[model samples]
Target: MTVQYKFPDNFWWGSAASATQMEGAAHEGGKGENIWDHWYKREPNRFFDGVGPETTSDFYYRYKEDIQRMKEIGHNSFRFSISWARLIPGGEGEVNQEAVNFYNDVINELLKYDIEPFVNLYHFDMPKEQQDKGGFENRDVVALFAEYAKQCFDLFGDRVKMWFTFNEPIVPVEGGYLYDFHYPNIVDAQKAFQVAYHTMLASALAISHFRKLDIKGQIGIILNLTPSYPRSQHPADLKAAHRADLFFNRSFLDPAVLGEFPTELIELLKEYEHLPAYKEEDLTVIKENTVDILGVNYYQPRRVKAKDHVPNPDSPFMPDWFFDNYEMPGRKMNPYRGWEIYEKGIYDIMINLKNNYGNIPSFISENGMGVQDEHRFLKDGRIEDDYRINFIKGHLTWLHKAIEEGCHTKGYHLWTFMDNWSWMNAYKNRYGFYSVNLETQERTAKKSAYWFKEVAENNGF
Candidate 1:
């Protein structure tokens, strides 16, 4: 007996990609250097196997074929970001006509195949010049981002109905400020707070601008929401989990969706004197420009417990200072990525949105497992990615339940369309339905791709 798990009518089905991760031609076509190019030049070894983004899947020249593949695979929609450096060269001045033509062609190609284009303006690829000017740390950069977003709207808004201001905006804060994983690496809590604040403000400013343009589309921001679970029902553990949620998830969620910062988060920041310098007018702008839609990117959940030991009072502040990660025994894991496989986290997130966030329109923007050395799984002419298929099915099972309970969840998109270079980790883990051979720049659809095509055509398995 074949089990049928049909989704709602008109549900979106596709995958997501970012410009820097997929589009090569880093220097050609008048594309200025982004932070990825700058960082790779300085520290190539930091990237996986000495591979950088200079010539990533060569999607810059192969998008036509890629879109044809997408159509064949039954993709009804696709999400991708625009590189600020590629579009504006320096990130704030004259637009590059070549870049404009490239994006316009890509959008038209997707539309020609009856695929809806979901465009995100920023995806952590800051232009080198913008980073030199303090990136999102400087207040001036917020307005500059708004201008860039307005330009995108003016140029492609007619065809691109869905616009996202930022994708996983909190990532840069965690990667650059609190950790040494990203560019301009600075391990400072205060700076991290400021960066996060400004990014949220920039998103609101973009949303405000989008509304004023009278474009027939929905504008939102994509957030990587990891539900925080306590180690036990103990009060201390629960409190620790709550605080972690506020810091990592609610800090951006409340402002983007609810149009205000959580009072608890604000109070804690104020107590530490780590709040970003902001005017009353900025708060008003954020409050008045909440997103019309939301894009939830879920991969894993956070399991936490109360701090095992008191931190040194003199140590610099950090979110983990309040709580410690608790590795639950017997928890499922994605060994390649070292992330827990908790499909229920997706359902919990949907229910949370429904119960608390007014069940706003949204979709799964990015959810796919990355496997290290995936070439080992290749069979015959295709990669036999059964694990990847199971991964998607498990998550989809939970997502289906959420929708059954009236969760207003609109779609589910995988993390990527093809294997491409990732920042820092750069090609370390493959997370795509189509495996790309770097040497030949050839894209071969994995076994999961065939499975997914049927799932999309049938609306489910």
Candidate 2:
């Protein structure tokens, strides 16, 4: 017998994209260059296929048509981020009316189609000017971010009720600060902890600001939660998993929802003398302000084991010091993206929210496969993305199970609505229901797009 899956009432059936990922016109409308534009210009070879985000899906110019397509896909809601540099060229001084007008137009267009708009303030694309001034590392950037959030609320809050402070806050710390993959790549674990702290502080400040605005809809932060698993029953493996969880998941999860940093986090950071700089009252603010909802983007779970190699005395201390990634033999995998396939990660996150944290309303804000060389699958005008169809269905099955078992999952939004410029990977991996033709500016819905429309209409698959 075939199994069936269904969603809750008023399930938001849409996808997510960032300003840097989807909106072209990077230099147009008095928009200052972001870190992405600067990074590509400095090192074009760093991005896959040498494709930058500047010439993305052209959503800046083609939003009306794109939004119309969203309606056809039965999207009751959509989530997209606003570029800070575009809105305020220098990141904190003058307001660029052109950007304000453009975003207002986009939000209005979505509403016209009866699709609710979920607007995110930041998505890893820090303004180059702000980065030069120390970005998230310096405490000053947090103040600027709060100001930017306030400006956004003052302008667009009336139309957009759901506000997100940041998308995948841990990503920048991991990918940018610790790993060499992202810009301003520094491998200092201390700096990574500081950056993570400032980001959470910024989120708390924004939530406090939202309370002042008295917005109608919910405000929250988006976390890419990775459930950590121990490799064995050994005490060392169990301890390693605990440390990994403290570093990756609890760093943001605790403060954003529980309104306080985990005590384990403090002890771990103290062991390394990596405590971030904080004032006397910062803890109070964090303990007081928590999000109204939780936006979880679960891609995969972390399989951790006790470190194989003892710590090299001369080597720089990193998060890997305590644990190593234990690749499970014969585990399901998504070869295209080179990531583990764990559909139950979604349910695990839900259960974590229900059991440990208060069952705050949450949603799968971003989850999808990123296929490299996807054009090879294109036939005629459509890309037959059966793999993507399977990916969504598999994950949705787990999500449905979680919800039926009383997880307060509100909705599921795919990683993207259409193929756009991904950071580092650029356009190499396409995670879209619609195919984007760069040469002719054509948009064609993949088979998954049609399949998703039915799922959205019926609230099931």
How high is the lDDT of residue 406 in model 1?
A: 94
Per-residue CA lDDT of model 2 for 1-461, tens digit only, reads 12277677888899999999999998999999998899899999989889887888899999999999999998999999999999999798999999999999999999999999999999999999999987899988999999999999999999898999999999888887898788877888788888999999999998889889898888999999999989888999899988999988998999999988899879877877888888869988888889999999988889999988899977877889899999999989989888999999888889989998888999999999989888788888678899999999989999998999898999999988988888898788889989888887688999999999999988897
TM-score of each: 0.99, 0.98
Off by over 4 Å in 1: 1-3
For model 1, how does the per-residue alpha-carbon lDDT over 10-39 read when each residue is reduced to its tens digit?
A: 999999999999999999899999999999
Q: Candidate 2 lDDT (Cα, whole model)?
A: 0.90
What are the root-mean-square deviations of the candidates from the true structure over C-alphas?
0.9, 1.4
Candidate 1 TM-score over all chains jointly = 0.99
